[model samples]
Structures are given as structure tokens and as C-alpha cells.
Target chain A: MLAGSQNRVQCTEIVLFGVNVAMSWAAVQGWFHKLASPPHFYVTAGRWVPWLGASTVVLLAVGLGWSLFIAPLDQYQGASTRIMYLHVPAAWMSIFVYLVMAGSAAVGLVWRMRLAEVIAASSAPLGAWFTFLALATGSLWGKPMWGTWWVWDARLTSELLLLFLYLGFMALQAAIPDRRAGARASALLALVGVVNIPIIHFSVVWWNTLHQPSSILRLGKPTIHPSILWPLLVMAIAFKLYYMTVVLLRARCALLERERSSAWVQQIVTEQIALCHPLR
Target chain B: MIVDPQTSPRLGRALRTVLVRDLTLALRRRGELANPLVFFVVVVTMFPLGLGPEVDLLARIAPGILWVAALLAALLSLEAMFHPDYQDGSLEQLLLTPHPLAVLVIAKVFAHWLTTGLPLLVLAPLLGVLLQLPESATGVLVISLALGTPTLSFIGAIAVALTVGLRRGGVLLSLLTLPLYVPVLIFGAGAVDSAAGGLSVVAHLSFLATLLILAISLAPWAIAAALRISLE
Candidate 1:
């Protein structure tokens, strides 16, 4: 009886793991499609903006406070190591959002889903911004540690290419006259280029290189002390919230533009104006 | 739209009709083809000027420089493939032909390869000599171009089809196709450089040939699909 119960618990755990992974990736599309229809999203944004804004503010305060003040200095990198609180999460988010952006694009293209395309388009600018942050912070960290502002290392070069991919996606969409066609074509390009990113990530490990291998993420236990790890964890959550706040704003804009001709859009616009001028 | 291939006479007539029509049109706008060729020569020459008076350094970088020039030259001409025809409604007329549009598109790609690719291949050896490349590398150079340039034409055709109707698509076309060209760039340059260093070049040439065959069989259909979207 105990064995069977344990087996059931194991199965449930696996199912929950799958759900979390899927939701992390698919939540943007699901939110936009199911609950965040033009009027619902608009009205909800009006109601929830305060909560989102407040939580984000609180999270940033706590996360940044914990990371910079409480985390112990690294043994190897010493003071220069503190840059991890900024660099690692930005880098992780850059790759994560790109995968989401490309996956959404593929879904949009194959299914002709306008909502998927809107989310995909909305992800591009955010992905580009994160990529810039990763590059800038990386350069800052590299200068003090590696003694140079730049190196043509594999990861660095590939990150630059990701920026180019984002720029190309934006340029193609803006340049194309037919918006739907532009979305489809750029989606195809994104799908094709997705393979390069993994190659970039593994290139250092695959070949003998000067660049250091994985530090925070690896198969074994993390090498860092707890004092360092806690702040890193806190900062990661803060960065994620920052991303959510920005995506919410962008998605709300996209929802309005995509559903402009719908009645809900008109009503939401009217309500927005009335809120802005309550005395009227 | 279906060709009864058992009727050899009709198949031959359809093929010839496409080739003749494309060639005649290309011949009239001879300047379109010349632009890419001139760009190729200019880019190749600019390298020697930029790198300065060291023969060894020029020879060392020759393979990469030549391949880069060829890649850019191919891209420069790609926009012309469907742009003028797309603009002037000739593509619509071609679409109306009883023969398959895929076959018609393939015919145009062939004409493009002949006018643009063949000239670059012929001119490559002269540029190779200017860079002080060894004679053995010259053979690898020509053969790689022979195999690699056709793949460029095939791949570029798809980008051209995708951007045929868009204004200011030339730069965007480069961005889309440049990454796809990296494997070809690596192998083509590897072949010439290996030969220049007196290493075996056969393996690289064979790989280039395999890629070209794969691209030739696949790209026409993809380009045709892209063309349909642009037109629609």
C-alpha cells in the first residue's frame, strides 16, 4: 500500500513539473487568448495595474537589497563576481524569451493565429532589450576581470548574433507592407535560426576554449557559497517580475491595436478616457 | 498545369520555351547582370587595396576574401530576380503559363546562375593569381565556386521570392540569407585554404557538392511557395 501511494506521488510530481514548464512558456499566449480578450485585458489591466506595480516595486526592493548587501563575495572572482547578480539573469532571460518568441511565431504561422503573432511581435522588443542588457553588463564584468571590454569569445559573438536576429525580425516586419505576410515570413526566419543558439551555447564546452564553463548551472551542486546563492536567487525573481511588468504593458498595447475594429476595443477606449477625466 | 511526361515532345517544348523566354528577357536588360559582376570585381579588388603590399598576407586571407565577395555578389543580384518582373506584372503573365510555375522559376534561376555565377567562377582565377595564391589552390578555388555558387543561386532565389513585393528588402534579404550561407562559406574557404597549404582539398569539395545537390533539389519548391505568398 505504501509503495503504491509513493508511486502515485511520483506520478503527480512529474505531472506538476510538466505543467509548470508548459505554463512558463505558454502563459503569454494563454493569457492573451483566453482571459485577456480586448475588453477583459483592458479592464483587468486597469484594476490590476496597481497590484502589479506595487508588487514589482516591493520585489525589486527586496531582491536588489538581498543581492547587493547580503551576498558574500566570491572566492575566485572576488568583488568582480557581484556582477553575476545582474549578468546571469539577464543572459538567461534573453535566451528564454527568444525561445518563447520563436515558438509562438511558429504556432502563429502554422495555425494562422493572430493572437500568437501579436504576442510573438510583442516579445521581440523585450527580447532585444534584454539582449542589450546582457551584452552591456557582460562587457562591464569582463573589463575588470578579463582586462578587456570585448573578446570575440563564442558566447559573446553568438549573443551579438541574437541581437542581430531581433533587429532583423523588427526590420522585416516594419518594412513589409502586408503585416500578416511579414509576420509569417519573419516567423519562418526565427524558426530556422533557432538552431544556431544551442550551437553557440555548447561551442565552448564542445571545443577547448579559454572561456570558463558553466558556473551557476551544472549537473552537480552549485560551487558558490550560500551567501552568494541567496542573493542570486532573489535577483532572478526580481528580473522576472520586471519582465512581466513590461510584457503586460506591451501586450495591452498589442491587444488594442489588433482588436481595434472590435466593439470591446471601442468600449475600453471610452472607459480609459472617462477614467482619465473623472470630473467630466 | 500537369505535364504528361510520356509525351516527350511537349516536355521538351515547354522546357525550351521557358529557357528561351527567360534568356531573351535577360539579354535585353544586360545591365542587370553586369551590376553584380562589377560589384564582385570591385569587392575582390578592394581587399588587395585594403590589406596593402604584403603578398603573403593577401595569399593567407585570399580564400576568405574571395568567398565573402562571391557571397555578397550573389546577394546583390538576388533582388533583381523577381523585383522587376514582380513590379511590371511579368510574374503574373508567367503564372498564367500552362507549364508549371515551378519549372518556369527553375528556368529563371538557371539563367541567373549562367549570367552571374559562371562569370564569377571565370573571373575567380584571375583574382586568385593577384592574391599570389598557389596554382593547386586555384583548382580547388574554381571547383568550389562551381559547386558553391549554384547553392547560393538556389538559396538566394527563396529570399528574393520572399521579399519580391517589399520595398527596401535588399538589406533584409542579406540578413535572412547570410546565416544560411555560413556552412557554405566555411567549406568553400576551407577547401581553398587547405589546398593553398598543400593539404587535401577533395573532402571539402565533395561536401560542397553534396550541399549543392541538396539545395538544388529543395530550394525551387521553397522559393515557389514564398513567391505564392508574396503574390497573394
Candidate 2:
């Protein structure tokens, strides 16, 4: 009788554990749907904006301060080498944000998720800006280091091509009048870009690239001094935070645009007007 | 879909029907057929004039010039690949059909290559002589172009499909496609450049063939998706 009761207890425990697993799985799915929905995501993202913005600003200030004032000068390249802080981080963000944009694009395409579409669309201009920043800053540094302005190096060419890809995406989106169709169409292009980007990166290696090899992303220990590497890494983090803050803000704007006729947007607009004009 | 596109007899019949229909349509407008080929010739000629009739310089640059002109010619014809079908309501009919849209897209792209890319391939040797391209290198140039232009047609069709719904998609189509064309240009011209310089052309040709196979296998689905989006 005691043994029977113990078996019963064990079976009850097993059933309860299975029940708990099922419930949590359902809850996670529910949370995902809630987050993916536009109005829900809008409210949630708006709440995140100030925090993201504050963190970004704080980190950026510190990163810049450390990068310019605190970091020691390289004995060989001297002051021009300091451009590494801006150039490397921007370059990293250019590729990092492209992956984000393309990944969101794929999600938006496959699931037809509205917030994913907004995130994908919002990320394009930021990626382009960082790419152009990287290119421009790298060129400025190159003129002094390499004795010329451009060499059509592998990374340089691929990055320039990446900028053009971003432009093409934006242009395609602008040309399409139907919002959903436009988003999905550009999403398709981004998927294709993801496939081709690696080819672009490697194809130009056949050319005798004069650009310096990567220092941080390679295998084994990074070749740079710890002090310089830290500031650069800190700057990378700050740029990433900046991207997150702006993208969330942009996603909110895009969501508003996408859902302009919805009731929630209408209520938010009216509330904003009332807040702006208290007398009214 | 039920019978499987590969084993079923319908796939072959469908491919032939589209190919014949496109070729017949292209033949009906014989003057338009010559436009890209003639454009290819004129563009090649302009290079000699712009750079002067310097044989050595022309020979040095012929591979790049011919490859680029061929690419542009292929691009010029690409806008028509689906625009006409889309306008005539056949594109909608195509989507509604039970057959896979990818098969139809590839058929149309193949017909487009036959009309545009083949002519450029045939004319490449003549232009090679005009550019004073090395006699030995001429073989490599023709072969590489023959291998490469079909890939361009296939890839360019995706852009055309995406742009077919827009009124002014001409410039937009080029902007979308030119970056994608870089790999083909590199390999096609690289093959000839290497051949002219007495370097082995094996690597470049293999790359071109690999790209062609990739385009053949993958481009149709992308074109079909783009066409669907445009229609939507």
C-alpha cells in the first residue's frame, strides 16, 4: 500500500512537471506574438527609448573622452592612428547592422511580421550612415598611412558595395507605393544581399589588396595593445548602443506610419497634441 | 507540382512553349532584335575613338570593354523580359497556373539570352579584332562571354521582375542590378586578361561556370518571388 502511494506521488509529480513545461511554452509563444504586434511593440519600444538613449549618450561621451584624451599615441603611426577608434567601430557596425537589417528582413518576409518589417526598414539608413562614416574616416586615415586616398582594397570595395546595396534597398522601398508589398519586396532583396555579401567580400581578394589585414577579428589574441583595444571596444559598444537607440526610435516612427489609421495611433496623436497645448 | 517538374513531360512542353512564344515575338520585331547587338558594336567602337586608335592600349583593355558592353547589352534587353508579359495580363495568368512559376521564369530568361546574349557572343570575336585583342585571347574572350552572358540574363531577370510594375523602373532596375553584375564582370574579363597575359585561364573560367550553374539553379525562384511581389 505504501509502495502504491509512492508510485502515485511520483506520477503526479511527473504530470505536474510536464504541465508546467507546456504552460511556459505557451506563455513564451504568447509573449512573442505580443512583442511582434505593432501597437504592443510600439508601446514597449517607446518605453525602452529613453533608457537606450541615456545609455548611448553616456557611453558615447565616455568612449570619446577615453579614445581621444586618455589613450596613448602609437609610436609608429602617431596621431593619425587614433582614427582607428572611429574607423574600426564604424566598420564593425556597418557589417553588424547589415546583418541585423538582413536578419530582420528575413523574419519579416517569412513570418509576415509587422514589427520585424519596421525594424528592417528602420535599420537601413543607419547602416548606410555608418558605412559612409567608415569609408570616409578610413579614407582620411588611408591618405596619411598608405600614401593615397584609395586602393580598391577588398574590404574597402566590399564596404562601398554594401553602401550601394543599402541605397538600392531604400530606393526600391521609396518607389513602391504599397507599404506591405514594398517592405516584402525589399526584404527579398536583402535576403539576396546576404547571400552575395560573402562573395563580394572574397571575390576582390583576387586583386592585390593594399588594405591592412584585420587586427581584432582574426584568430588568436588581437595584435593591438590592450589600452588601444579597450577604447576601441568601448567605442564599438557605444556605437552599437547608439544604433539600438536610434533604431528603436525609428521603428516607433515607422510603426506609427504603418499603423496611422489604427485606433491606438489616433489616441496617441490626440494625447500628444493635448500634452503640447495644455490650454487646448 | 503533382507530377514533379523534373520527371513530368509537361515541364519540357511548358519550357518549349514559352521559349518558342518569346522567340516568335522577338522575331516579329526584327529591328528591335538588332538593337542590343548594334549597341554592343557602337559602344565597342566608341572606346577606340575615345582612347585613340592605339592598338596596344586597346588590346590591353579589350577584355574589360567587351565584357562591360556585353553586360550593358544584356541589361538593356532585360527590362523587356517580363514587362511585356506583365502588361498583357499573361503574368497574372502565369501565377494562376498550376505549374511552378520558377520553370516559366527560367524559360523566359533562356529565351531572353537566346535573343540578346547569343548575338553578343557571336559578335564578340569581331569586336575582339577591332580592339586588337590578342588572337589567342579571342578564344578565351568568346568562350568566357558565352559562359557568362547567360548568367547575366538569368540574374538580370530578377531585377526586371521586381521593377515590372513601376512606370519608371528603367533607372531603378539598373541601380539594383549593376552591383550584382560585378562578380561576372570580374571573372569574364579576368579570364581574357589572364589569357592575354599568358597566365592560365582555368581559375577564372571555372568561377564563371560555377556562377552560371548557381544562377541557373537559384535565379528562377528569386525572379518568381519578385514577380509575385510586383503583382501584389
Q: Among these predicted structures, which one has the highest lDDT?
A: 2
C-alpha DockQ for predicted model 1: 0.30
TM-score of 1: 0.79
- The segments of candidate 2 whose C-alpha lies over 4 angstroms from its true place after superposition are A1-20, A209-222, B1-9
Tens digit per residue, CA lDDT, model 1, B1-232: 5655675346457667767877788788888768988898899889878879698899889998999999999988887778888989988777766666776788889878888899999999998988888888998899999999998888788878878888788888898777667657767887898899998888778878977887777777677767876787
TM-score of each: 0.79, 0.93
lDDT of 2 by residue, B1-232 (tens): 3566656558678789889999999999899999999999999889988999988899899999999999888888888788888889988988876678998888899898888888887899999999999999989998999889998998888888888899999999888888888889888999999999999999999999999999899989999999998998
Give, for candidate 1 chain A, the lowest lDDT window spanning 10 residues. Answer: A210-219
Model 2 interface Cα RMSD in Å: 0.9
Q: Which pairs of residues collide in candidate 1?
A: none
Give the TM-score (vs. native) of candidate 2.
Answer: 0.93
